[model samples]
Target: MLEKTGVPTPEQVKRAAPTEDRLKKGPVAVVECFQSIPCDPCQYACNQGAIKEFVDINDVPIIDHEECNGCGICISQCPGLAIFVIDATYSEDKGLVKVPHEYTPLPEKGEVVTGLDMAGNEACDAEVVKVQSAKSLDRTPVVWLAVPHDCLMKVRGFRRKGGAE
Candidate 1:
């Protein structure tokens, strides 16, 4: 289904998601990479060593949720845009999701944007909390959004209001 639609099935997403207990612990990286491509930047970007070393160059990443502090350093390093950091404990009603943004005119902090699901559908309204575009990120900017707690997993991307894509 993923090869046909470019969107991973729900079951695949479940397998990539961290456990409920791990989510409650705080922010953690969620590697949604399912394909076995020759990629390992996420593992190398993790200073905490949370992303396990690849046994093979094409092996999918294995994240040690306990070791990840959810700093989101790996978010931008992932060329495939498969890495994200979720902070469920950010608030009782909201959660923080850090996603990669490669488009021009990035969303500004405090701006309200339309959160999107895996299939690029509208999921919810999210507030931009932070935008990290350090030179160290290699030009991939990471946008932090605060969305409803219920949409923590659903909101994977966002569309800036009246902004060019």
Candidate 2:
């Protein structure tokens, strides 16, 4: 349930899912996040010291897969609900997209959730595979969605259709 406003497209997700071979040989690279409000947890979460040394805390997170373990520690640390993890290397059937899911009545694994884009509009349908959270994540659940190969670049977020916050 994206907003009645600017919704993202699957093509955007595709364009956004560009590959970085360096991540495969080393740590995972994080991208596709455009919003800069209320975030910067990635700096403190990176135990390897890859993020802090590379940029300022106020700056956006620039992950160096060379040191990233894809541990997803930073995925939950975000506050604006921005940021995600994408693995285009996954099988042809689908790929992994880790998002900061912070809505009530969160969808369950295997449940078909509504895929949304940056503007908070419907883009496609995706399946929820993993939903994780810890006290450190600040109540934000790191939702892993199994999205169609085509939806990779378009589906930036999720929408539950109708509900109250």
lDDT of 2 at 111: 78
Give the clashing residue pairs of candidate 2, or none. 1-159, 3-120, 9-154, 10-154, 12-153, 13-152, 13-153, 13-154, 14-153, 27-65
Distance from true position, residue 28, model 1, in Å?
Answer: 0.5
lDDT of 2 by residue, 1-165 (tens): 213434434453444343556423422536544434445666777787655553444565565556666666766765655457666656657777788877778777777878875666677877888778667677888888777766665576786545422
Predicted structure 1, TM vs. truth = 0.96
Worst 10 residues of 1 by lDDT: 156-165
lDDT string, candidate 1, 80-157, tens digits: 999999999999899999999998889888999999999999999999999999998888999999999889888999
Q: Which residue segments of model 1 deviate by more than 4 Å?
A: none
How big is the positional error of residue 5 in model 2, measured in Å on the Cα after superposition? 9.7
Clashing pairs in 1: none
